[model samples]
Target: MEKSNQLFNQEQQIIHRLLLNAPFIPSVGLLTGQVGIALAFYTYYRHTECAVYGDFAGELLDNALESLDKSIDIAFSNGLTGIGWGIEYLILKGFVDGCGVEICENIDQKIMESDPRRISDLSLEQGLEGLIHYVLIHISASIKQNVRLPFDSLYLKDLYTVVKQACQEDIPDSFRSLAEIYMDFIEKQEPIDYPLHLFSFIDIVHLDTDKLTDYPLGIKDGLAGLLLKEITNE
Candidate 1:
Protein backbone atom coordinates (compact mmCIF):
# COMPACT_ATOMS: atom_id res chain seq x y z
CA MET A 1 0.00 0.00 0.00
CA GLU A 2 2.86 2.43 0.78
CA LYS A 3 4.54 1.60 -2.55
CA SER A 4 1.31 2.20 -4.43
CA ASN A 5 0.86 5.55 -2.64
CA GLN A 6 4.43 6.51 -3.59
CA LEU A 7 3.68 5.74 -7.27
CA PHE A 8 0.54 7.86 -7.12
CA ASN A 9 2.49 10.72 -5.58
CA GLN A 10 5.07 10.52 -8.35
CA GLU A 11 2.35 10.54 -10.96
CA GLN A 12 0.75 13.58 -9.43
CA GLN A 13 4.07 15.40 -9.37
CA ILE A 14 4.64 14.64 -13.03
CA ILE A 15 1.18 15.84 -13.99
CA HIS A 16 1.75 19.11 -12.13
CA ARG A 17 5.00 19.65 -13.94
CA LEU A 18 3.32 18.93 -17.27
CA LEU A 19 0.61 21.50 -16.65
CA LEU A 20 3.12 24.18 -15.79
CA ASN A 21 5.40 23.41 -18.69
CA ALA A 22 2.62 22.95 -21.22
CA PRO A 23 3.37 25.43 -23.99
CA PHE A 24 -0.29 26.21 -24.67
CA ILE A 25 -1.32 26.86 -21.06
CA PRO A 26 -1.32 30.64 -21.51
CA SER A 27 -3.86 32.51 -23.69
CA VAL A 28 -2.59 34.41 -26.72
CA GLY A 29 -6.00 35.99 -27.28
CA LEU A 30 -5.55 38.59 -24.55
CA LEU A 31 -2.65 40.25 -26.34
CA THR A 32 -4.17 39.83 -29.78
CA GLY A 33 -7.52 41.30 -28.76
CA GLN A 34 -5.84 44.35 -27.27
CA VAL A 35 -3.95 44.89 -30.49
CA GLY A 36 -7.15 44.52 -32.53
CA ILE A 37 -9.04 47.14 -30.51
CA ALA A 38 -6.13 49.55 -30.56
CA LEU A 39 -5.86 49.22 -34.31
CA ALA A 40 -9.58 49.76 -34.78
CA PHE A 41 -9.38 53.01 -32.83
CA TYR A 42 -6.28 54.21 -34.67
CA THR A 43 -7.98 53.52 -38.00
CA TYR A 44 -10.95 55.65 -37.02
CA TYR A 45 -8.69 58.51 -35.91
CA ARG A 46 -6.49 58.69 -39.02
CA HIS A 47 -9.23 58.64 -41.65
CA THR A 48 -11.63 61.20 -40.21
CA GLU A 49 -9.88 64.13 -41.87
CA CYS A 50 -12.82 65.74 -43.72
CA ALA A 51 -16.01 67.23 -42.25
CA VAL A 52 -18.10 64.56 -43.94
CA TYR A 53 -16.35 61.88 -41.91
CA GLY A 54 -15.74 63.99 -38.82
CA ASP A 55 -19.07 63.10 -37.22
CA PHE A 56 -18.48 59.52 -38.15
CA ALA A 57 -15.08 59.63 -36.51
CA GLY A 58 -16.58 61.03 -33.35
CA GLU A 59 -19.09 58.22 -33.38
CA LEU A 60 -16.32 55.68 -33.75
CA LEU A 61 -14.49 57.16 -30.80
CA ASP A 62 -17.66 57.00 -28.76
CA ASN A 63 -18.04 53.39 -29.75
CA ALA A 64 -14.51 52.68 -28.60
CA LEU A 65 -15.16 54.19 -25.20
CA GLU A 66 -18.32 52.17 -24.92
CA SER A 67 -16.40 49.07 -25.83
CA LEU A 68 -13.80 49.83 -23.19
CA ASP A 69 -16.46 50.42 -20.59
CA LYS A 70 -18.18 47.16 -21.43
CA SER A 71 -14.93 45.26 -21.27
CA ILE A 72 -14.18 46.65 -17.85
CA ASP A 73 -17.63 45.81 -16.56
CA ILE A 74 -17.27 42.25 -17.80
CA ALA A 75 -13.98 41.92 -16.01
CA PHE A 76 -15.44 43.22 -12.77
CA SER A 77 -18.46 40.96 -12.91
CA ASN A 78 -16.29 37.92 -13.41
CA GLY A 79 -13.48 38.97 -11.12
CA LEU A 80 -14.74 36.70 -8.40
CA THR A 81 -15.11 33.63 -10.61
CA GLY A 82 -11.39 32.76 -10.67
CA ILE A 83 -10.74 34.50 -13.98
CA GLY A 84 -8.30 36.92 -12.37
CA TRP A 85 -9.94 40.33 -12.29
CA GLY A 86 -6.83 41.43 -10.44
CA ILE A 87 -4.88 40.99 -13.64
CA GLU A 88 -7.52 42.88 -15.60
CA TYR A 89 -7.34 45.71 -13.08
CA LEU A 90 -3.59 45.74 -13.35
CA ILE A 91 -3.72 45.83 -17.17
CA LEU A 92 -6.22 48.67 -17.14
CA LYS A 93 -4.09 50.51 -14.60
CA GLY A 94 -1.09 50.14 -16.88
CA PHE A 95 -2.99 51.47 -19.87
CA VAL A 96 -4.21 54.40 -17.84
CA ASP A 97 -0.67 55.14 -16.78
CA GLY A 98 1.03 54.52 -20.11
CA CYS A 99 -1.03 55.22 -23.23
CA GLY A 100 -4.67 55.54 -22.28
CA VAL A 101 -4.79 59.25 -21.48
CA GLU A 102 -2.15 60.14 -24.03
CA ILE A 103 -3.96 58.35 -26.85
CA CYS A 104 -7.18 60.25 -26.19
CA GLU A 105 -5.47 63.63 -25.94
CA ASN A 106 -3.36 63.16 -29.02
CA ILE A 107 -6.21 61.80 -31.08
CA ASP A 108 -8.30 64.79 -30.12
CA GLN A 109 -5.52 67.15 -31.09
CA LYS A 110 -5.06 65.40 -34.41
CA ILE A 111 -8.75 65.66 -35.18
CA MET A 112 -8.78 69.33 -34.36
CA GLU A 113 -5.80 69.89 -36.67
CA SER A 114 -7.58 68.28 -39.61
CA ASP A 115 -9.55 70.41 -42.10
CA PRO A 116 -12.95 70.68 -40.49
CA ARG A 117 -15.00 71.20 -43.63
CA ARG A 118 -13.76 68.54 -46.06
CA ILE A 119 -13.51 64.77 -46.03
CA SER A 120 -10.27 63.00 -47.11
CA ASP A 121 -12.02 61.32 -50.05
CA LEU A 122 -10.47 58.08 -48.83
CA SER A 123 -12.59 54.99 -48.57
CA LEU A 124 -13.49 54.44 -44.95
CA GLU A 125 -12.98 50.72 -45.26
CA GLN A 126 -9.55 51.21 -46.79
CA GLY A 127 -8.52 53.56 -44.02
CA LEU A 128 -9.67 51.13 -41.34
CA GLU A 129 -7.64 48.32 -42.93
CA GLY A 130 -4.55 50.52 -42.88
CA LEU A 131 -4.95 51.27 -39.19
CA ILE A 132 -5.34 47.58 -38.47
CA HIS A 133 -2.10 46.92 -40.32
CA TYR A 134 -0.30 49.46 -38.17
CA VAL A 135 -1.66 47.87 -35.02
CA LEU A 136 -0.59 44.43 -36.17
CA ILE A 137 2.93 45.62 -36.74
CA HIS A 138 3.17 47.47 -33.46
CA ILE A 139 1.89 44.53 -31.41
CA SER A 140 3.57 41.77 -33.37
CA ALA A 141 6.84 41.75 -31.48
CA SER A 142 5.28 41.78 -28.05
CA ILE A 143 2.66 39.08 -28.71
CA LYS A 144 5.23 36.87 -30.37
CA GLN A 145 7.35 37.05 -27.28
CA ASN A 146 4.59 36.35 -24.79
CA VAL A 147 2.65 33.57 -26.52
CA ARG A 148 5.44 31.72 -28.28
CA LEU A 149 3.92 28.28 -27.94
CA PRO A 150 1.27 26.33 -29.86
CA PHE A 151 -2.46 26.78 -29.36
CA ASP A 152 -4.49 24.66 -26.95
CA SER A 153 -8.29 24.35 -26.61
CA LEU A 154 -8.17 24.57 -22.85
CA TYR A 155 -6.26 27.82 -22.96
CA LEU A 156 -8.56 29.19 -25.69
CA LYS A 157 -11.63 28.43 -23.55
CA ASP A 158 -10.09 30.16 -20.56
CA LEU A 159 -9.18 33.13 -22.72
CA TYR A 160 -12.69 33.26 -24.18
CA THR A 161 -14.19 33.22 -20.70
CA VAL A 162 -12.05 36.11 -19.67
CA VAL A 163 -13.04 38.10 -22.74
CA LYS A 164 -16.74 37.31 -22.26
CA GLN A 165 -16.53 38.63 -18.74
CA ALA A 166 -15.02 41.79 -20.11
CA CYS A 167 -17.99 42.22 -22.46
CA GLN A 168 -20.67 42.35 -19.78
CA GLU A 169 -21.01 46.15 -19.70
CA ASP A 170 -23.20 48.28 -21.98
CA ILE A 171 -21.65 48.66 -25.42
CA PRO A 172 -22.93 49.89 -28.77
CA ASP A 173 -24.76 47.20 -30.70
CA SER A 174 -22.32 47.58 -33.59
CA PHE A 175 -19.26 47.07 -31.40
CA ARG A 176 -20.99 44.21 -29.65
CA SER A 177 -21.56 42.43 -32.94
CA LEU A 178 -17.95 42.88 -33.95
CA ALA A 179 -16.77 41.55 -30.60
CA GLU A 180 -18.98 38.52 -30.99
CA ILE A 181 -17.63 37.79 -34.45
CA TYR A 182 -14.08 38.14 -33.19
CA MET A 183 -14.63 35.51 -30.54
CA ASP A 184 -16.33 33.20 -32.99
CA PHE A 185 -13.44 33.45 -35.40
CA ILE A 186 -11.05 32.47 -32.67
CA GLU A 187 -13.22 29.53 -31.75
CA LYS A 188 -13.43 28.25 -35.30
CA GLN A 189 -9.72 28.66 -35.72
CA GLU A 190 -8.95 26.43 -32.80
CA PRO A 191 -7.87 22.93 -33.86
CA ILE A 192 -9.70 21.16 -31.08
CA ASP A 193 -13.21 21.11 -29.67
CA TYR A 194 -13.93 23.58 -26.88
CA PRO A 195 -17.24 23.94 -25.05
CA LEU A 196 -18.75 26.73 -27.12
CA HIS A 197 -21.92 27.34 -25.13
CA LEU A 198 -19.95 27.19 -21.91
CA PHE A 199 -18.48 30.49 -23.05
CA SER A 200 -21.48 31.95 -24.87
CA PHE A 201 -20.58 35.64 -24.76
CA ILE A 202 -18.91 35.74 -28.18
CA ASP A 203 -20.93 35.97 -31.39
CA ILE A 204 -19.33 34.46 -34.45
CA VAL A 205 -18.66 36.81 -37.36
CA HIS A 206 -18.30 35.89 -40.99
CA LEU A 207 -14.63 36.29 -41.81
CA ASP A 208 -13.11 36.95 -45.19
CA THR A 209 -10.76 34.06 -45.75
CA ASP A 210 -8.51 36.21 -47.88
CA LYS A 211 -8.22 38.93 -45.26
CA LEU A 212 -6.41 36.58 -42.92
CA THR A 213 -3.19 37.74 -44.58
CA ASP A 214 -3.90 41.38 -43.79
CA TYR A 215 -2.52 41.46 -40.24
CA PRO A 216 -0.52 39.84 -37.46
CA LEU A 217 -3.48 37.63 -36.74
CA GLY A 218 -2.68 35.80 -39.95
CA ILE A 219 0.76 34.92 -38.71
CA LYS A 220 -0.59 33.98 -35.31
CA ASP A 221 -3.07 31.67 -36.96
CA GLY A 222 -0.44 29.93 -39.02
CA LEU A 223 1.95 29.46 -36.13
CA ALA A 224 -0.75 28.27 -33.81
CA GLY A 225 -2.04 25.81 -36.34
CA LEU A 226 1.38 24.34 -36.89
CA LEU A 227 2.10 24.04 -33.21
CA LEU A 228 -1.22 22.43 -32.38
CA LYS A 229 -0.84 19.90 -35.14
CA GLU A 230 2.70 19.10 -34.09
CA ILE A 231 1.82 18.67 -30.45
CA THR A 232 -1.25 16.56 -31.07
CA ASN A 233 0.59 14.34 -33.49
CA GLU A 234 3.20 13.72 -30.81
Candidate 2:
Protein backbone atom coordinates (compact mmCIF):
# COMPACT_ATOMS: atom_id res chain seq x y z
CA MET A 1 0.00 0.00 0.00
CA GLU A 2 2.77 2.41 0.82
CA LYS A 3 4.59 1.67 -2.37
CA SER A 4 1.43 2.05 -4.43
CA ASN A 5 0.72 5.44 -2.88
CA GLN A 6 4.24 6.49 -3.60
CA LEU A 7 3.96 5.46 -7.21
CA PHE A 8 0.63 7.23 -7.57
CA ASN A 9 2.10 10.42 -6.15
CA GLN A 10 5.02 10.19 -8.54
CA GLU A 11 2.68 9.77 -11.49
CA GLN A 12 0.58 12.69 -10.30
CA GLN A 13 3.60 14.99 -10.15
CA ILE A 14 4.64 13.93 -13.63
CA ILE A 15 1.16 14.65 -14.97
CA HIS A 16 1.10 18.03 -13.23
CA ARG A 17 4.33 19.00 -14.95
CA LEU A 18 3.00 17.84 -18.30
CA LEU A 19 -0.18 19.85 -17.86
CA LEU A 20 1.81 22.99 -16.99
CA ASN A 21 3.79 22.80 -20.25
CA ALA A 22 0.92 21.68 -22.48
CA PRO A 23 -1.37 23.96 -24.45
CA PHE A 24 -4.97 24.31 -23.27
CA ILE A 25 -6.37 22.10 -26.04
CA PRO A 26 -3.95 19.20 -25.77
CA SER A 27 -3.75 19.59 -22.02
CA VAL A 28 -7.37 18.55 -21.89
CA GLY A 29 -6.62 15.56 -24.09
CA LEU A 30 -3.76 14.59 -21.84
CA LEU A 31 -6.04 14.88 -18.85
CA THR A 32 -8.53 12.65 -20.62
CA GLY A 33 -5.79 10.11 -21.06
CA GLN A 34 -5.16 10.31 -17.34
CA VAL A 35 -8.85 9.69 -16.81
CA GLY A 36 -8.57 6.62 -19.03
CA ILE A 37 -5.71 5.37 -16.92
CA ALA A 38 -7.84 5.77 -13.84
CA LEU A 39 -10.76 3.96 -15.43
CA ALA A 40 -8.49 1.15 -16.60
CA PHE A 41 -7.15 0.67 -13.10
CA TYR A 42 -10.67 0.82 -11.70
CA THR A 43 -11.96 -1.79 -14.11
CA TYR A 44 -9.04 -4.07 -13.50
CA TYR A 45 -9.32 -3.73 -9.74
CA ARG A 46 -13.09 -3.86 -9.38
CA HIS A 47 -14.35 -6.07 -12.19
CA THR A 48 -11.60 -8.57 -12.67
CA GLU A 49 -12.53 -11.91 -11.08
CA CYS A 50 -9.01 -12.70 -10.20
CA ALA A 51 -7.72 -11.20 -6.96
CA VAL A 52 -4.11 -11.35 -7.89
CA TYR A 53 -3.38 -7.71 -7.04
CA GLY A 54 -5.64 -7.51 -4.03
CA ASP A 55 -7.72 -4.45 -2.96
CA PHE A 56 -5.18 -1.75 -3.71
CA ALA A 57 -6.27 -1.50 -7.31
CA GLY A 58 -9.86 -1.13 -6.23
CA GLU A 59 -9.05 1.68 -3.78
CA LEU A 60 -6.91 3.52 -6.28
CA LEU A 61 -9.47 2.92 -9.02
CA ASP A 62 -12.24 4.36 -6.89
CA ASN A 63 -10.39 7.62 -6.32
CA ALA A 64 -9.24 7.77 -9.93
CA LEU A 65 -12.76 7.23 -11.27
CA GLU A 66 -14.10 9.94 -9.04
CA SER A 67 -11.53 12.36 -10.40
CA LEU A 68 -12.26 11.24 -13.97
CA ASP A 69 -16.02 11.73 -13.71
CA LYS A 70 -15.56 15.14 -12.20
CA SER A 71 -13.25 16.09 -15.07
CA ILE A 72 -15.82 14.81 -17.57
CA ASP A 73 -18.55 16.88 -15.98
CA ILE A 74 -16.35 19.95 -16.23
CA ALA A 75 -15.77 19.30 -19.95
CA PHE A 76 -19.48 18.85 -20.63
CA SER A 77 -20.32 22.05 -18.82
CA ASN A 78 -17.84 23.77 -21.12
CA GLY A 79 -19.68 22.69 -24.34
CA LEU A 80 -17.32 20.02 -25.62
CA THR A 81 -18.44 16.74 -27.16
CA GLY A 82 -17.96 13.82 -29.66
CA ILE A 83 -14.21 13.26 -29.87
CA GLY A 84 -13.81 13.09 -26.10
CA TRP A 85 -16.40 10.36 -26.09
CA GLY A 86 -14.64 8.41 -28.80
CA ILE A 87 -11.26 8.72 -27.11
CA GLU A 88 -12.70 7.49 -23.81
CA TYR A 89 -14.39 4.58 -25.55
CA LEU A 90 -11.16 3.56 -27.20
CA ILE A 91 -9.27 3.94 -23.96
CA LEU A 92 -11.75 1.84 -22.02
CA LYS A 93 -11.88 -0.81 -24.74
CA GLY A 94 -8.12 -1.03 -24.76
CA PHE A 95 -8.06 -1.40 -21.00
CA VAL A 96 -10.92 -3.83 -20.48
CA ASP A 97 -10.85 -5.98 -23.61
CA GLY A 98 -7.96 -5.22 -25.93
CA CYS A 99 -5.36 -5.45 -23.19
CA GLY A 100 -6.06 -9.17 -22.94
CA VAL A 101 -7.45 -8.71 -19.45
CA GLU A 102 -10.33 -11.01 -18.55
CA ILE A 103 -13.04 -8.72 -17.31
CA CYS A 104 -16.62 -9.84 -16.64
CA GLU A 105 -18.00 -11.49 -19.75
CA ASN A 106 -21.29 -9.65 -19.30
CA ILE A 107 -19.67 -6.19 -19.15
CA ASP A 108 -21.37 -4.91 -22.29
CA GLN A 109 -24.85 -5.57 -21.01
CA LYS A 110 -23.99 -3.84 -17.76
CA ILE A 111 -22.97 -0.67 -19.58
CA MET A 112 -26.28 -0.61 -21.40
CA GLU A 113 -27.95 -0.60 -18.01
CA SER A 114 -26.22 2.66 -17.05
CA ASP A 115 -27.87 6.03 -17.59
CA PRO A 116 -27.46 7.27 -21.15
CA ARG A 117 -26.41 10.64 -19.76
CA ARG A 118 -23.47 9.02 -18.06
CA ILE A 119 -22.39 7.65 -21.41
CA SER A 120 -22.49 11.18 -22.78
CA ASP A 121 -20.33 12.42 -19.94
CA LEU A 122 -17.66 9.82 -20.64
CA SER A 123 -17.64 10.73 -24.32
CA LEU A 124 -17.47 14.45 -23.74
CA GLU A 125 -14.38 14.03 -21.58
CA GLN A 126 -12.43 13.11 -24.68
CA GLY A 127 -12.93 16.56 -26.17
CA LEU A 128 -9.26 17.51 -26.33
CA GLU A 129 -8.09 14.32 -27.98
CA GLY A 130 -10.97 14.40 -30.43
CA LEU A 131 -10.34 18.03 -31.32
CA ILE A 132 -6.68 17.33 -31.92
CA HIS A 133 -7.48 14.44 -34.23
CA TYR A 134 -10.07 16.54 -36.00
CA VAL A 135 -7.51 19.23 -36.76
CA LEU A 136 -4.97 16.68 -37.89
CA ILE A 137 -7.36 15.29 -40.48
CA HIS A 138 -8.64 18.65 -41.73
CA ILE A 139 -5.10 19.67 -42.81
CA SER A 140 -6.34 23.09 -43.88
CA ALA A 141 -7.39 23.97 -40.34
CA SER A 142 -5.00 26.65 -39.19
CA ILE A 143 -3.55 26.96 -35.73
CA LYS A 144 -5.05 30.41 -35.92
CA GLN A 145 -8.52 28.82 -36.08
CA ASN A 146 -8.53 29.23 -32.31
CA VAL A 147 -6.65 32.45 -31.78
CA ARG A 148 -6.54 31.87 -28.04
CA LEU A 149 -4.56 28.65 -28.41
CA PRO A 150 -0.87 28.88 -27.54
CA PHE A 151 0.21 25.71 -29.33
CA ASP A 152 2.20 25.51 -32.57
CA SER A 153 2.37 22.57 -34.98
CA LEU A 154 5.54 21.30 -33.35
CA TYR A 155 4.02 21.51 -29.88
CA LEU A 156 0.92 19.61 -30.96
CA LYS A 157 3.10 16.93 -32.50
CA ASP A 158 5.07 16.62 -29.29
CA LEU A 159 1.85 16.40 -27.29
CA TYR A 160 0.61 13.54 -29.44
CA THR A 161 3.90 11.75 -29.09
CA VAL A 162 3.79 12.09 -25.31
CA VAL A 163 0.19 10.90 -25.18
CA LYS A 164 1.10 7.82 -27.20
CA GLN A 165 4.00 6.97 -24.96
CA ALA A 166 1.97 7.56 -21.79
CA CYS A 167 -0.84 5.33 -23.01
CA GLN A 168 1.52 2.54 -23.98
CA GLU A 169 3.27 2.61 -20.63
CA ASP A 170 0.18 3.06 -18.49
CA ILE A 171 -2.02 0.45 -20.15
CA PRO A 172 -1.16 -3.11 -19.24
CA ASP A 173 0.09 -5.71 -21.69
CA SER A 174 -3.35 -7.18 -22.20
CA PHE A 175 -4.68 -3.87 -23.46
CA ARG A 176 -1.68 -2.71 -25.52
CA SER A 177 -3.25 -4.07 -28.71
CA LEU A 178 -6.30 -1.89 -28.17
CA ALA A 179 -4.12 1.17 -27.64
CA GLU A 180 -2.29 0.35 -30.87
CA ILE A 181 -5.59 0.07 -32.71
CA TYR A 182 -6.60 3.53 -31.51
CA MET A 183 -3.26 4.90 -32.71
CA ASP A 184 -3.80 3.24 -36.07
CA PHE A 185 -7.24 4.80 -36.33
CA ILE A 186 -5.68 8.21 -35.76
CA GLU A 187 -2.87 7.56 -38.23
CA LYS A 188 -5.22 6.35 -40.97
CA GLN A 189 -7.76 9.14 -40.47
CA GLU A 190 -10.38 6.58 -39.60
CA PRO A 191 -13.55 7.69 -37.90
CA ILE A 192 -13.90 6.68 -34.25
CA ASP A 193 -17.18 5.94 -32.55
CA TYR A 194 -18.11 5.36 -28.95
CA PRO A 195 -17.24 1.75 -28.27
CA LEU A 196 -20.63 0.62 -27.06
CA HIS A 197 -19.51 -2.99 -26.82
CA LEU A 198 -17.11 -2.31 -23.95
CA PHE A 199 -19.33 0.07 -22.02
CA SER A 200 -21.08 -2.50 -19.89
CA PHE A 201 -17.91 -3.36 -18.06
CA ILE A 202 -17.37 0.09 -16.60
CA ASP A 203 -19.14 0.91 -13.35
CA ILE A 204 -18.84 4.58 -12.47
CA VAL A 205 -19.40 5.01 -8.75
CA HIS A 206 -20.25 8.25 -7.08
CA LEU A 207 -17.91 9.50 -4.41
CA ASP A 208 -19.10 11.84 -1.74
CA THR A 209 -16.98 14.66 -0.31
CA ASP A 210 -16.58 12.70 2.88
CA LYS A 211 -15.10 9.80 0.95
CA LEU A 212 -12.79 12.03 -1.03
CA THR A 213 -11.44 13.54 2.14
CA ASP A 214 -9.83 10.24 2.94
CA TYR A 215 -7.71 10.23 -0.22
CA PRO A 216 -4.19 11.49 -0.76
CA LEU A 217 -3.56 15.15 -1.59
CA GLY A 218 -3.47 14.57 -5.33
CA ILE A 219 -6.56 12.40 -5.42
CA LYS A 220 -8.43 14.33 -2.77
CA ASP A 221 -8.15 17.93 -3.90
CA GLY A 222 -5.11 18.40 -6.08
CA LEU A 223 -5.06 17.17 -9.68
CA ALA A 224 -8.79 16.83 -10.23
CA GLY A 225 -9.61 20.13 -8.62
CA LEU A 226 -6.85 22.01 -10.39
CA LEU A 227 -7.73 20.68 -13.82
CA LEU A 228 -11.45 21.14 -13.33
CA LYS A 229 -10.94 24.72 -12.23
CA GLU A 230 -8.63 25.48 -15.14
CA ILE A 231 -11.09 24.07 -17.64
CA THR A 232 -14.28 25.34 -16.09
CA ASN A 233 -13.11 28.73 -14.78
CA GLU A 234 -15.21 28.53 -11.65
Best by TM-score: 2
CA error at residue 52 for candidate 2, angstroms:
45
Cα RMSD, each candidate = 22.1, 17.7
lDDT of 1 by residue, 80-114 (tens): 11112112222332322233222333322332232
As a whole number from 0 to 100, the lDDT of residue 66 in candidate 1 is: 37
Shift in Å, residue 41, candidate 2: 27
TM-score of each: 0.19, 0.23
In model 2, residue pairs whose N, Cα or C atoms come closer than 3 Å (at least 3 residues apart or on different chains), thus clashing, are: 84-126, 84-127, 85-123, 99-174, 99-175, 100-174, 107-200, 107-201, 111-200
Model 1 misplacement above 4 A: 1-34, 37-99, 120-234
lDDT of 2: 0.33
